[model samples]
Target: MFTKRAFLTLLAICIGGGTAYAQSDPLPSWNDGAVKKSITEFVAKVTTQGGPDYVPPAERIAVFDNDGTLWCEQPIYFEAAFALDRVKAMAAQHLEWKQQQPFKAFLAGDKKALAEQGEKGLLTLVAAAHSGMTTDEFAKSVADWLATAKHPRFNRPYNDLIYQPMVELLAYLRANGFKTFIVSGGGVEFMRVWAEKAYGIPPEQVVGSSGVTQFRLDAAGKPSLLKTAKVQFIDDGPGKPAGINMIIGRRPILAFGNSDGDHQMLQWTMAGSGARFAGIVHHTDAAREYAYDRPSKIGQLDKAWEEAKAKGWTVVDMKQDWKKVFAFEP
Candidate 1:
């Protein structure tokens, strides 16, 4: 059902034996297989002009869970490590924290003590370190730490361990007119500092858990939100979809994640009326990255992996599916 002009345009490119128009094919580094095929097909249908399956650019929204999907989330969550480091480094300012239960545990580098504190202790650490600073200061701290922090196993900067195939998929989707948004459990401010350079996703497009802040003029009298030790937002589980709806407005045509935290995000994306796609990056490559799934304390898979097959969702197995892990040679 092509109009005359549209038909002639594509036809001419085929005819003159000219270098053919790119078909938004195989996402460069992605292996030529089912995963790549599904991703390409989904993107092509949505972005092609005048096609019956075409969706307008405004509605061409894609949501991604940042940690395991875009990079590595093994051994522990990246932001959790950030919290632990912040507590130890800033302990000088608050000697009181050194005596506190979880803070003492964190300060001592006692993994067993930390485990004893569990979720409540983790929350205590997060609230303490993440709050009490301005947004700009928080972002700078994250950038500074990320620059120096090495993965315990890899001994490379955490940011450098980003998955190669996923990176290609992001760029490929963008070439097909999709706007990508990060819906992660990590702090929004933490990811915003490096997301643009790391993922080609702008700061405004990233969404994540956040703490409360208040307007306070610094010594320079510039307007800014100085952080407060209160939970303003927690963009995980059901909160992810709600955050996306509130912030991005458009429902996603595609969604990718690696944990149960993103279950709701996939739900929101697939709930879109037509041609929606959702996938999960299951960490099954211990050699290349880390072998982990449902049992892993940090990025637990459980329900996401179970529901993926039931829902016909593509599961990217790190060992079998991805031809390579980090784009840079490990």
Candidate 2:
């Protein structure tokens, strides 16, 4: 009973609406540029059925570096700050710390002395602070710290400082059938405490450095895992690839990171067969975020930066490529 002209108009409207919906932007936080185009195009090619570059859903593995890549790690790594705080909290019980070199310098706010202590000193602090507790207790402690600790410059909870564009990218990849995992140099226990809530990546999907732990049975017949001071693994640089191979058991098709620590991971991903994507989130926005490469002590991006450029990997200029850095930005 419908008029032919009216039927044609309804059909046109439906078609147009569907087209608009299909064209909606998945990475709204990213600016319209070559970088964005490359990302979208890569995704399209890899997802196209029967295409040469098409990757099966089960094989679409993506890995990301957590600190500085997904969130900020400046002034000092957040875990370092937590370790320092833990040292202060435990100082009263350990009188020997008053005479210890790094502890004494740290407690007295001697920056020069603390710097002299270097990596060894830092490890000592971490061991002192992170060990001697049950895994559940350690997790609760990390969660409690995250609930209260704020970044000095941003004055916001550390978890709240995650990159908006990267978060969107994660979701877009997941929507396209990519399984995301976080591969970081930070402590496995520390990252697992808040990563799921912050990045939509669950704890089991996180691969990171770890300290030794022992299973214990309490007098009440309660079985628990106790964290020990012994270092087990360091998931950085070459260790990144080793961790991926050991844990994931599958080479990632896509890998993203911010510094030299991720160099091996990027290299490993690119070495895989078929379509591969490697990206570096360059911290060029000093105003909205911290910026440093090579010279900086924390999150140095020297060798990896050069490699990314030479290999034609997407190196995102955070200041230019992202319209919004953080969700809190106006």
Candidate 3:
């Protein structure tokens, strides 16, 4: 019933609206807020050619923490859950574990007992579960676990719990010529197994704690690297900056994390010359996600929370800043 001019005018309006929508939101999962604004503005300033804060594409390194930042780390860490499952699976082989401190606690679902064992106990569990296997075998095990293991809360595959906004942010940064890397406290091998597929970050760009690996040839003349119980490096707290230096060889201009463990990395990133960005993903949504900070034993955010306020770093309130928590969420 419309005239040709009227139809053409409507088409033009529709096209213009689509174009604006496409150009406006690189991070669609993020809500319109100060946190989102800061991130976009920083990226824009650094990427604009010949701008005062312009940085070369080659130097646009962005580092992100894995647990509690890019994904959920609640009830228990995903890696720890994997290790505990491994313990249970291997319990038949090691009968003595029934009487062991951490093993017994893990087997009994005794959170109190397991916590008492502390970092030393956690390391013991990691060594027992992660070691004595070939690198390929370990990778396969992790892959298989990720494929089958469902989150206790969401009942979805663990990898599916990754934050949708963070995924968008990663893509946005990469699209703008930034190289993204995961700087985490989790085991390097464990994360490398699935990180590339989940985060679009290759294995080489992942910096994390590592265990010793020894190369050997089998009787059939097959060469393989065997994981050992000895810890080579721990990539948490102060170790984050050191790992970045040793592995990445350059300080990241942008860094994001969710815990006090990432405090040093944020510090190191902001300490760099020129325009830089540091942000913390504060877990403030108990309904959609976990809400814990100072009191929580896992992924504690006390010191970093205080420092973020003091230094004017962007602290993203998950409940407020994210339009969607996971891709699966309606």
TM-score of each: 0.89, 0.92, 0.91
Clashing pairs in 2: none
Displacement of residue 147 (Cα, Å) in model 1 is: 1.5
Runs of candidate 3 exceeding 4 Å displacement: 1-23, 108-116
lDDT of each: 0.85, 0.92, 0.93
Q: Which model is ahead, 2 or 3, in terms of TM-score?
A: 2
Q: Which stretches of candidate 1 lie over 4 Å from their true place?
A: 1-26
On the 0 to 100 scale, the lDDT of residue 62 in model 1 is 86
Number of the candidate with higher lDDT, 1 or 3: 3
Give one clash count per candidate, in the order shown. Answer: 0, 0, 0
Show where candidate 2 strays beyond 4 Å.
1-23
Lowest lDDT 10-mer window, candidate 2? 14-23
**Candidate 2 to native Cα RMSD, angstroms:** 4.3
lDDT rank order: 3, 2, 1
What residue pairs are clashing in model 3? none
Task: State the lDDT of candidate 3 residue by residue for 191-215, as single tens digits.
Answer: 9998888899999999999999999
Listed per candidate, the RMSD to the true structure in angstroms reads: 5.5, 4.3, 4.2
